[model samples]
Structure formats: C-alpha cells, structure tokens
Target: MSQELKTKAHLIYINGEWSGADLDELEVVNPANGQVIGCVPNAGEVEAHEAIEAAHQAFQTWSQTTAYERAGYLKKFHALILEHQEELAQIMTKEMGKPINESRGEVASAASFLEWYAEEGKRVYGETIPTHTQNKRLQVWKKPVGVVAAITPWNFPAAMLTRKMGPALAAGCTIVIKPSGDSPLTAIKMVELSEQAGFPKGVINLVTGSSSKIGKAIMENDKVRKVTFTGSTEVGKMLIQQSAHQVKRLSLELGGHAPVIILNDANIDAAVEGVVASAFRNAGQTCVCANRIYVQSGVHEEFVDKFTKAVNLLKVGNGAEETVTVGPLINQASVQKVRHHVEDALAKGATLLTGGVSLENDGGNFYAPTVLSDVTASMVVMHEETFGPVAPIQKVETIEEAIALANDTPYGLAAYVFTESVSQGTRLIEQLQYGIVGWNDGVPSATQAPFGGMKESGFGREGGHEGIESYLESQYVSMGIN
Candidate 1:
C-alpha cells in the first residue's frame, strides 16, 4: 500500500482566486502515519472577513440568477468531482484515515448531492392560495437568503461539504465555507473544482482555521444571512448563542448517539452485519454511527456471538491497504475519547464481548472494533455520542423497553430497527424520537431524502426538498384584482 499523499497548497479560495492568508500555515497531518501530508492556511479574522465580504458582495447578483443558471454551474461542479474522483479520494483518505475505497465511494455518493440539488433547484416552486373573495388572490415566492456560512466537520469531508454547498448554491445563495483543519484538502479541491465549473467570483469561498475567531466573525457579520454547521453538540449550541443577536437563519447537524434495536424476529445475521457497518464504518467517526445496540433478550446471546466474531474479523491498519476495514481515528484525541468511553463502560459493569483496546503501539490513532455486552442505561456509553468504533449492546425484554432506552439520550439523529414484521418496524419508527430511521437496512445516505435530527441532535435538514428551503425565506403576497 502506498503511503505518500499529495500536497494541496496551503491557500484560501476567495473570490475565484487562490489567496494567501496573513496567518501562518497549519500543517495537515496524515492521521494514519502522523506525516505532514500538506498544509492549509490558518485563516485569521482578516481572511474570514474577506471571504464573508466577497460572498456578501456576490450575493447581490448571484441570488438573482435563474435556478437554471445556478444549476448549470452545479452540474459542471458535479462532473468535475467525477473527473478527478480518484485524486480527491486519495487526498481524503490521507487527510482523514478513512479506508481508500470508502473515500472513493464517498466522493461518488457526494456527487449525487450536487446533481440532486441541481435538478431540485428547478422545483423550488411556490404556491398560490385561494381567498374567499374572488377578487383576492394570495401567492407566495421563495427568495434566496443572501450570504451563507457553511462550517463543516472532517468526517465524511467531501459528502458533508457538497451536501451543504449543493443546496445553498442551487438556491442561489452565495456560500463561505470553513472546513475542519484535519481534512481541508478535499474541501479545497472541491472549491477549486467549483471555480473551474464557472461559478461567479465569491459564489463560493473557503477559509481554513481559526475556528473560534472565524466563527465569531461569521456570527457578527450582518452580511452573512444564514449559517449551516456540522459538528459537536456543544459547538452547535455555542454558534446558536453567538448568532442569537443576529437572528441568522441557522441549520445545524450536531452530535448523535444513534441506537440500533435488534428484535427477536430479526435475522440475527443481517442485524449483526448492519450493526457492524453502522458502528465501524469511517473508523466510527460519524455523527449518526450506531452508538448503542439494544438486543431482545431472546436473541441476545446468539446476536452477541455473531456480532463479536464479525467485528473481530475486520482488519485494522492504515486505510491505504485494501484489506484494512478499520483505519486510524482522525487523531490522538479520538483515540483518547474512544478509550474513555470503553473504560467508562467497563467501570460501570459492562462486559467486553469482543475488542475494547486501542492499537497505540501500531503508531497511529487506531482502535479495535469493540463490542461491549452487559451494558445498561447508567453507563456513559449509553447516553454519550461515542463517535468511534465502539458499540455497546444492552439487552431488553420488551419493545417498550427498547424504545425507552433508545430515546433516553439527548440526541435524536438517526435510529435503526431490525425486524421481520413490517408493523413492528413501523411501530419502532413512529415511536423513536430520531429524525432519520432505518428499518432492516442502514441509510447509505442518498441525496433524494431529507437527513437531519430532531431535538438537540440539530436543527434543519441537509438533503432532499427541504435542504434548499433552509437557504431561502418565503414572501407572501396578497393582491386584490381590480
């Protein structure tokens, strides 16, 4: 397996030009091997304002452009992603430690967001309402909401970026994006492609680093009409509080401690496989990764046996290797966080069904795919968003108990239910507080459906018809004929 990663020059994409920051360069490390794969500008307050001003300036004309015109740029952008799919995938894998093939698959799936929104832009239709008076008519129009700030996380770098940008651009809103420091290369490349795709100057801008400072500027900037963010629950709350004064339109995709319920009627084999896929994919660094598995007591033993074996069979190594199903965590902090969850679970009387240790000796931020049985609601793993390759299995005697346990967390992002009976699946779906529900199969995330969470998990949807709506505000007009 090759270890060398490309150098995406440390520059900010502002106003259709690659601009240098006044601040120093932040080294982009390859999480798999701790090598400096590249560097990106640690954009300071000045650069942040520049990007915001640029987006604000461009929004005047960009927002007036026809949906067809905006979609054309997005279509070209989607094509450009595919044109350099392999290159983008390589950069993503190196920067974030997701397996190589997973990175490629992400890039491919990511293109769909652009394509979906490009076409969906045409369907941003308004409605006409009938009034009691024949002479009166009521009509509504959806108008683009000026400059948008897209603050994204590193996990699923390409997909998350596109999901935010695709809808924003399609809605004729100019965007200023701030990608995670650990994985800016893919975001940078995507923006670079956007430039080549014929987007007008400042239609899209990317400013890297200075999370707090840049975020503060974004919140304070009156020109920034809307904001979309994907990160921790705490950070999302902070952004909310900061932007409160501005009353900006905000869309947040925050933390999730998603649950997977395995009922007695479920296919143990299929349920186990889905659990592994949900909990371990992307080295378990996902907002919606299944954090807790509730198994019916009737099949608990058999399910644990099969699930443990499946997890153990996964190869753990650098993502560059095809056989390595689990790669390193984004960095050492992820290693520590995952370890903290495992240790906390064990302290609370959880029994390790399979692996529960880190591979620190292997020289990267790697942790074994872990499964913990005998877990209970009192354990930290039960309530917290364990954003790593750790799965805690708790046994429940009744569907009611399973549902209660699943809804116990503060988050309500995504949930999974495995059952042979359709009614049972629908019941769980209706009862679950989560925004997205998967029955018998995990949601692989296509662009056609809405994706988001209810309650504290986050506000606003990121995909589907509703995705673009967040970037626009409605205006109602009631007219009198004659």
Candidate 2:
C-alpha cells in the first residue's frame, strides 16, 4: 500500500500523463492520528484550464463513439475498481478517516455506479413523434452534452466521483474532475484505474489543489458545458450563479438536514435499530443521515432509552483499527463544528442522554456517539446540518406535529418515518416534501433509485435512469419526405 501511494503520489494527471511532480506539494494528513500520509501537487487555475482544454479536445472524438463502445470502457473501469478495492479502501481510511469496513462499503458502492451505468448507457432511448402531415417525420435523439467539470466532496470520496463520472462517460462525454483536497488520494487512485482501463487520452482528467482557483477557472472556461457538484449549499449556490454566464448545465447535490420520525404505532425496536444505523454511519458525516429525530409522545421515552443504548455500543477510534466503528472527523474544523452544535443544544435546554463530550486519550479526532433528548425546534442542531455523530431528538404529540417538524427545515433531501400502520405510512410518505423518503427503513438510497434533493437541498437526480440523462442533450430532427 505504501509503494502504491508513492507510485502516483505527488503527481497530477493531465491529458493521460502525470505532471506536477515538482510543483508545490501539499501534505495529505491522516485524520486518524494527525500523520502526514503523502503529498500531492497543489494545482491551481493554470492546471484547471489545461485540464478543461484537454477534456474539450477529447470530447470531439469521444462523443462520437457508439454506446456499445462507451459501455465497454465503463465495464473495464468497473472491474478495475473491484479488483483494486482493498488498496482503495485503505487509502480512503487513511485520508478521510472512515472505518475500514465503511471504506470498503463505499468502494463497493462506487463500483456499483460504474457497473449500472455501463448497461444504462446503451438504454438511452430517443423519442419519435407522429407528424400531422404524412410526408413529414420528426424524431428526438440524445447526444453527449460536452466537457463536464465534476467537483466532489470528501465524505464519500470514491462513490461521489463514480456517481458523476460513470454517467458522464457512459453518455459519451469527457470529464475533468476536481476531488476535495482533503481526500484527493482516493480520487487519484481511481483516475489511475481509469488510465489502466484504456480510456482514450484526455477522456478523463483529474486536478488537485486550491479549490477556489480551480473552481473559478472551470466556471470561466467556455468549453466546459456542464458542472456537477456535491457539497455545501453555499458553494452550490455560487456554482449556480456562475453557470448563468455560459448557460451551462448544472447539477448540484447540496447540504441536507434529514429528519427521522417515529410514530406512536411504530415498531420501537426496529425504529431504534434503523436510526442507529443511519445516524452513525460514516460517523454521521453523510448528507442523508438522520440529523433531527422526532418521536410521538406515546413512545418517546421508550424509544429514547433504546436508542441511547444502541448509540453507546458504537466503537470510536482510529479507522485503521479493526474493531473501531467510528473514526475521526476529517479535520479540526469539523470537530469544532460538531462540538459547537452539541454545546448550543445543551445551552438551549436539551438533555444529553448518553455521550456529549469528545473522547479523551483517543489520539485522534474522535467524538463519543451522542444522543440528546428534550430537544426543541429552535435549537441550532435542529436547524443546521451537524455533520457529526450527535443525534438531537425531540418528542411530538401527534403525527401531524411530527410531519410539520420534519418539513420545517429549508432542506428537502431525505426523510424517514417508522409506523406499523400502512395507511398512516402512506399518508406521511405523500406529505413528507422530501426528494427521498423511507417509511420503515433508515437507509433508502440504492444504486437503482433516483437520489437527489429539493428546495435548498438543490436540484437534479444522480441515480436510476435519471443519472445518465443529466449528461446528455436532446436534439430534435424534423424531415420532409416525398
């Protein structure tokens, strides 16, 4: 693994060649123990433009390839991801601080996107319209949009890239990806596999370094016809505004403050299990994890008791450790943010049920899996996406109140409800006002399902059949026949 990291480390891939070996190096730190794992070139605006140029040039030929040919390349890429899954998982654990098991799961999820898109590329269907005049024929064809600029987040480094890259490439479009600097190693490794998969030169490129300069450069480039981003709402808004100048296509999967509601007729045991799994996965760093949990007054006390015990069982330590379930936050800023949210909740009269403080002597950015009760709607934790392991739960008197509280947020990414009554579940699902809803399940996202948000959570879907459509443009053709 060390040799693998050194082989491509400190280099930026451009036009199918590795450069920036001597550029200003930025250290990649292991959040687990504050160790410098390796260094990568701090590429800036210049490299970003170069990558865009390369992708633009490649798109001319790459977009001409048949859907079967494009699917072939995607299939190879998917296989390479699974073949090198172990190394990729290790790098992710080192750089991003998710547990080894979770990292492995992410790797699998990442590969699944490529595999699904490989077959889905061939399924991009066109439409035919019957004309009023028998002599005229009209049809619609789907074509590649153009060069795509993908900006991915560090939380699910591998999965986020493949989710965007798979659809873009499968649609016969070239891509220039800018992975988060905090977790660029995993992205670099994935790009390396792309090269080995025999993707044509400039078909796929990656640059790492200052996000601000690269983002600005990509937005300013006329060749980049589409920009896809997954991050905070503030940054997504900026990208949306930047796209207006070129009328560039945009797909933004921004911030989420997901809510989980447990009704009076809910299965308390299953509800507790579901919440624990969803809330603590990736240490609650995921955008869809349950941040605000609401339970009906009839079963609030019992649910809280069981939920606290489940949260306490989560092992917190370095991700490299086999037994550790929860790892450190990506950096100190994340740690501070989590701490601030917890403190604010407590100051606002929320009760700390199990864990609230950072774990001492852990030698890493580890926080105890915390559960809070008596939480109110006005608390900061209720309003903001904590992006940590702290679960702030409130009690609601009725189903109507639970639904109201869940939908009060500006985000409409995901929501969950636990109820044994099928009629009640159906009614709640219809009125949830979220892009994705889980009735009795905590984790509802799958590779085949359309995953995205509404409202402030941003627009566009990433999975199912809708994933590949974002990278394609529809061309209407009208013909006069004798």
Best by lDDT: 2
| Candidate 2 whole-model C-alpha lDDT, 0 to 1 | 0.92
Q: Model 1: per-residue lDDT, tens digit, 180-224?
A: 998988999888888889899989999998898899889989999
RMSD of 2: 1.4
Query: C-alpha displacement of 308 in model 1, angstroms?
Result: 0.8
In model 2, the runs with Cα more than 4 Å from the true position are 1-4
Whole-model lDDT, model 1: 0.89
Prediction RMSDs, each to the true structure: 1.8, 1.4
Leading candidate by TM-score: 2
Model 1, which residues run further than 4 Å from truth?
Answer: 1-9
In model 1, what is the error at residue 378, expressed in angstroms? 2.0
Per-candidate TM-scores read: 0.97, 0.98
lDDT of each: 0.89, 0.92
Candidate 1: lDDT of 130? 80
Model 2 backbone overlap count: 0
